[model samples]
Each structure stands twice: as C-alpha cells, then as structure tokens.
Target: MTTDTDTALEVTPDAAAAEFDRQVRTLLALGYPALSGRSPEQFAALVAPLRAEAVARAGSAAYPAGPAGPETAPAVTGRVPFVLVVGRALAPVERTMPLTTLHGGRLPGFVDRSFEPGSLERFLATEEARPPGRDGVHLLCEVERGEEFCGVVPGDAMATVAERGRTPLTLEEGIALLTLFPEILVKNKCFSLGGSRCGDRRVPALWISKRAPKLGWCWEGNPHTWLGMASAGARHA
Candidate 1:
C-alpha cells in the first residue's frame, strides 16, 4: 500500500518560500479579508513576520531563512496539518451573488446559532465532521458569515458565559482573534462546505453572521467576515 512516506517528497527552502509567496498572492486575488484593506506592500509586510515564523518552525532544511537574517526565524517545534475556517456575513440578496457566482446558482442554507453551553458538542454531532490532517495540531475552521458583527472564539480557546451579564465576546475581538491565529483563518468571504471538503471530514460547522456591517471597514460589496475554529490536532501543513 502507498503510505504518506511513499508520496512525501523533499522540498527545497527556496522553492517552499516561493510557493508560500505565490499562495499569499493567490489569496489576495481571491479577495481575502485580511489583505483587502492593506496595500500590496503593507500586506507583504504583515505576512513577512508570519512567513519568517513559519520557516523557523519548520527548520532550515524545509524552509531556510536565506538572506533574511536569523531574527526572522521562529522557534522550532513539531509540525501538523491544519484547515482554515472562513466566515462572512451577507444579506439575503448579497448572499445570492456568491451562491450564483461560486456555486452554480444554488443557495446553501447554513443555520445560525449562538455558541452557548453544550453548543460545541451538539454542533460536532450534527454539523461538524472529521477533516483531513496530521495527528498533531489538527485544525477545524467554522465561519460565521452574517449581516452584523458578531464574536468568534478559537476552537482551542475556551470561553465563559455569565448569567446576569452579556457574553464575553465582541465583533472586533473575534476578528482580532482570527487574525492572530491566521493558520486557522482562511480570511475569505465565500466557502462551500460540500465542495470544500478535506479527507473524510466535512467540517466542524460554520457560524453565519446575522449582524450589520461595521463602518470604515475596507472590503466593499460584502459586509460580513468569517471566524474559524481549529483543534490541537490540526496545524498549517
């Protein structure tokens, strides 16, 4: 039988770096939310640090530092596979465009529900399915595309609910959280679960936002964003 090792081949550092840059550019062309507001130079700068960190973690053989300098390197650790969860908010009409444009004229009906107590478990049972990845640092992304700005929590991170007061999450906080953990954040507005499946697992769940768009946000034509959740078994591969 063909194993992962049989298919696995070595990649040079330069080739890997070039491929990474290419992927980033491709994502930008696809209207990634993180790269939307920033200029090309600014976007490059933002991703530079991340690229350095990834290289350092992967080691010199897989991703050498090159002429960039040692400061760019991130601490080395074990590697794993990961999936990014992209979410976005859309109006009844706005949502139709992506559905028609991206999914061949059919509308996808993803339900909206709060992440209350037992919500994760229920979602896992009903909505989520296993995703493809390595054994360590597995990632599962759940996006909430909606009209309003809601909050998101990392799958690995925990949240607490208060009885007398409101939840401990805000829209900005949620986006920031995803930004901080870009490995699991797809940073896109449109996604199709049925078509975008990894391995045998469909996905954990997607949280479609129901809030209104925030003012001063750069992306046009769409007023929503996505938040993805991931597991420890998932990582960026």
Candidate 2:
C-alpha cells in the first residue's frame, strides 16, 4: 500500500546530496563569483568563446596591488558566514568551498535562483555593524597557496563595496543601524522557522539557505550566530 506522498517524501541519499551541493555553490558564488567553483567543462560553458581571452589576461597578470597597507593586514581574502533574510526565505552566503555543486550560470557556476534581489546590501549592513576587530572574521581562508591565513575585514571595507558597486549599502547607514533595536531589521526567517529534535536542542536547520550544501546551519562554520539571531527576538527593554 505505497502512497504517492510517501514516495515523494522518501529520504533519498542522492537527492539530499544534490541539495547540499546546491547550497555550497550558492555560498561560494555569492562570496567570490569572480574565480573558483567550477569544473573544466563548466568553465568551458561559461567561457567557450571567451576562454582563451580570459587566459591571455590571466597569464599577463601583474602584481598590481603593489604592497599591503596597514589596512589590508593579515593579507589573505575571506568572507563571513552570512544570513540574508529575504521576504519569506533565508539566503545564506559564505566565503568557502563549494562541495558538490555542478555547473551552469554566469561565473563561478552557482544556481542563479539562489539569490534574491537587494539581499546583498542587507548582509553588508549586518557585517559592517560588528566587523571582525582587526584580527578578522572567523573565516579560514587560503588566498596565497602555502601562505593560507584568516583575512582582515578593514574597518572601512564596507566603503570598498560601495566603490566597487557591489552593494548600495552605505557604510554610514550600517553604522547608524547598529545602535537601534534589532527587530527593526526584521528576522522573518526566524519567525517562519519551525524545529525538530536533534537530541536536546531544537535545531532550526531550516534557517540555512535553500541552496545550502548540507542539512543544517551548523555546517555554516558559525552555528553560534544563530543564537544571536534567536535571542534578538525578545528585546531586553
């Protein structure tokens, strides 16, 4: 007596793996869409006609940044585990490796549907509020081969985002938002969250991006951040 609903909900290892891969690709694509996260075939699809053009440019690359400033200390590049609460969904973006995400769509080969409009700005605003004190965010980055290290997020790095036109989130506005009540920003994700038992704690695994490469936020490298998000719901005032 097999029902269609049971067949649809059956836990298939392959399907779960695919879901995880999608999320990982989304994270990496959002973080460093310029490079990384692709197979040779996928890369070919993205560049096909322009592949050689890009290679010609890469081979002629120069040490343009010259030298690092006190600002760019800790040198390597990295990004924090981000949580983007969009409309009725949560888009988690991270600067890390994409596990099993396979090809197609712009550069870095992410599932394009993963992103939502204007979410990047909101994410940037959050990061600017409590930046990684000179030491850098919790990201374990590997920018220079054999010279891997955690990268610094300059106090004014948010300004760089604006200069590059990555996001419209102005550094000025981010600083201002920090002092206000957290509820104003709106955590619809949490409000919409439901939970299940994973032992003692009720894990809000659903909070992870729909594109995530794994089942839970603990896989995000910053599980503790969820605590802050949860507690913020009830203001001490």
Alpha carbon lDDT of each predicted model: 0.28, 0.22
Global CA lDDT computed for model 2: 0.22
Candidate 1 Cα errors over 4 Å, as ranges: 1-6, 33-36, 59-203, 206-237
| Stretches of candidate 2 exceeding 4 Å from the true structure | 1-46, 56-60, 63-156, 164-237
Worst 10 residues of 2 by lDDT: 141-150
lDDT, candidate 2, 99-210, per-residue tens? 2221111122122333345433343323222222231111111111100111212212223333433321222221111111121122222110111112222222222234
User: Which 10-residue window of candidate 1 scores lowest in summed lDDT?
Assistant: 74-83
